[model samples]
Target: MTEISTLIVDGILAVLLVSVIVVCTIVYRRLGTIKSGQAELRALVDQLNTAVVDAQRSVANLKTSATEIEGRLQIEGKKASAIADELGLITEAGNNLADRIERGLSGATAAKKQQAPAETSASKKQQEEILAALREAR
Candidate 1:
């Protein structure tokens, strides 16, 4: 009876030892997995932070470029307006010159008609021949 009791005690001790080892190994593996997950999460956070910084910088650069383009556009618009004003002035000057030329031509034609009666008939005939020649040249 004493030997049977010893054998039973030994068997229980062996079972308890095996259970403790398995539990310890499982806990160690779980701890390692947790540590690995923490490392991956940290890496993801770092990448997200870097991307945010890069995006902010890009936005700033874009804003600067937009401001520059706006400035250039304003300058060009001013130049275009000045050119349009100059063209308008030139057109007005051309219209004034054309009116002056038309008035001069009409005055010269009236003066020539008034002088025609004072000329001799032979001179008047000669003038008519010259006018016909000029018309044929045109």
Candidate 2:
């Protein structure tokens, strides 16, 4: 009876050790899964940080481009204003020329009217002289 009791106690101890080993293996596997999940989370965070930096750089470049374009537009606007001023001066010159031509034509027309009666008397005397010469020739 004493030998039988000792054997049964040893068998129970063996079973308990086996059960504890299995529980420890399960816990270790769970810890490894948690570590793998943490690594994946860290990689995702790194990718997000890179994306944010790239977005900021793009915004800065766009702002610079916009500023340059605005400056160019302002320069073009000044050039257009200068061209318009030159055109206005040319238009004024043309108008002044037209006024001078109109004045000259008016003066010529008045002079011709004053000379018409004198020209007609001179023409009549020349015709009488021509008629006398023709009679002599005959």
**Candidate-wise lDDT, in order:** 0.82, 0.80
Best by TM-score: 1
Alpha-carbon deviation at 47 in model 2, angstroms: 3.0
Candidate 2: list runs displaced more than 4 Å.
1-41, 113-138
Model 2 poorest 10 in a row by lDDT? 129-138
Indicate the TM-score of model 2: 0.49
RMSD of each: 8.5, 16.1
Model 1, position 98: C-alpha lDDT score: 59
- Itemize residue pairs with steric clashes in candidate 1: none
Task: Please write out the lDDT profile of model 1 over residues 16-124, one tens digit for every residue.
Answer: 9999999999999999999999999999999999999999999999999999999999999999999999999997886676566556555655677797756567755
Misplaced by over 4 Å in model 1 are 1-28, 106-138
In order of appearance, the predictions have TM-scores of 0.55, 0.49
Question: What is the alpha-carbon lDDT for the whole of candidate 1?
Answer: 0.82
